[model samples]
Structure formats: C-alpha cells, structure tokens
Target: MKNSRFSEAQIMSILKQAEGGAPVSELCREHGMSSASFYKWRAKYGGMDASLISEMKDLAE
Candidate 1:
C-alpha cells in the first residue's frame, strides 16, 4: 500500500503559506496545487495562526 499521508513538516509548511494569506488562486498557481487541496488542508489543520493567516504572502522574487 502506498502510504499517502502528508508529513507534519509538509503540512506545516503548507499551513504556513496558507497562514500567510496568499491569494487562494495565487497559491494554487504558484504551488501547482488546487483550491480544493488548499481547503482540504485548511479543514484538516484548522489551527494555524489567524493573524498570519490574514497577512500577505512573502513569496520569493
């Protein structure tokens, strides 16, 4: 069986990016992820820092 679970580190990293409040569309485009995946992660790990969750992204130039 392929253990297809996300690691804590991976989840946290995504959570961090999500917490940083990059536009959902932007995140989906930049990370090659989907809005559904983002929402799924958000539902699974719904305790990220709200303040950070509302802040702008710190994406690399």
Candidate 2:
C-alpha cells in the first residue's frame, strides 16, 4: 500500500476541523489536498483517534 503524505494525527486534525464547521473547500485549499482525499480519509478514519490508528497499524504488522 502507498504511504499517505499526511500522518494519522494530521488526518485526524483535518477531520476535526471539518467537523468543527470549517468549509471542506477551504480546508482542502489550505491543506493543499483535494476534496476527494479528504472524503476518503473521513470514510476510513472518521471517529478514530491517533492511538487507534497506531494500534491498527501495529495489528496490521
């Protein structure tokens, strides 16, 4: 699998920003990522935290 440019913590921060009423378009522009990427991350990581992501990665290994 390809590695992501943003770390899990960064992804979580971005998602939290979106949930905090930040406009998706503005976030995408500010983050230099496309809306699709944001949505994909949301689908995969929504409701998950950094510790959970690390645990998942550890389990995957």
Candidate 3:
C-alpha cells in the first residue's frame, strides 16, 4: 500500500483512474487512501489539469 503523502504525480494518476470510471471505493482500497482524503484531494485539485482548465475556461462564455 502507498503512504499518506503521495506526490503530485501520484495524485494525478489516481485522479485519472477515478476519471476513467474506476470506482472511488476501489481506488481508496487499492491505494490505501481514505474516502475523505480522496474527496479532499479531488476538491482541491479538481480542474487543475492545464488542458482541462483551458477547456473549462473556453466553455465558461
């Protein structure tokens, strides 16, 4: 199991998994993360990806 302080890249990878339709509970179990931690990271880093951010901005009009 991974440790608590996952790096940014790790976070991104998990986020990708979540986005790819891997169940959040599965991610938490496979990665040894708590539901709260996962949700917290999602909220903090949600839409932080450069390409996604640009697309969102373009749609905001």
- Each prediction's TM-score against the native? 0.56, 0.92, 0.71
TM-score of 1: 0.56
> Which scores greater on lDDT, model 1 or model 2?
2
Clashing pairs in 3: none
Question: What are the runs in model 2 whose C-alpha is more than 4 Å off?
Answer: none
Each prediction's whole-model lDDT (CA): 0.66, 0.95, 0.82
Ranking by lDDT: 2, 3, 1
Q: Give the per-residue lDDT digits (tens) of candidate 2, residues 1-61.
A: 8988998889999999999999999999999999999999999999998889999989989
* Per-residue lDDT value at 16 in model 1: 80
Model 1 lowest lDDT segment of ten: 52-61
What digit string (tens of lDDT, one per residue) describes model 1 on residues 1-61? 5753555456667768767876778877876767887788778657855344434224311
Number of colliding residue pairs in each model: 1, 0, 0
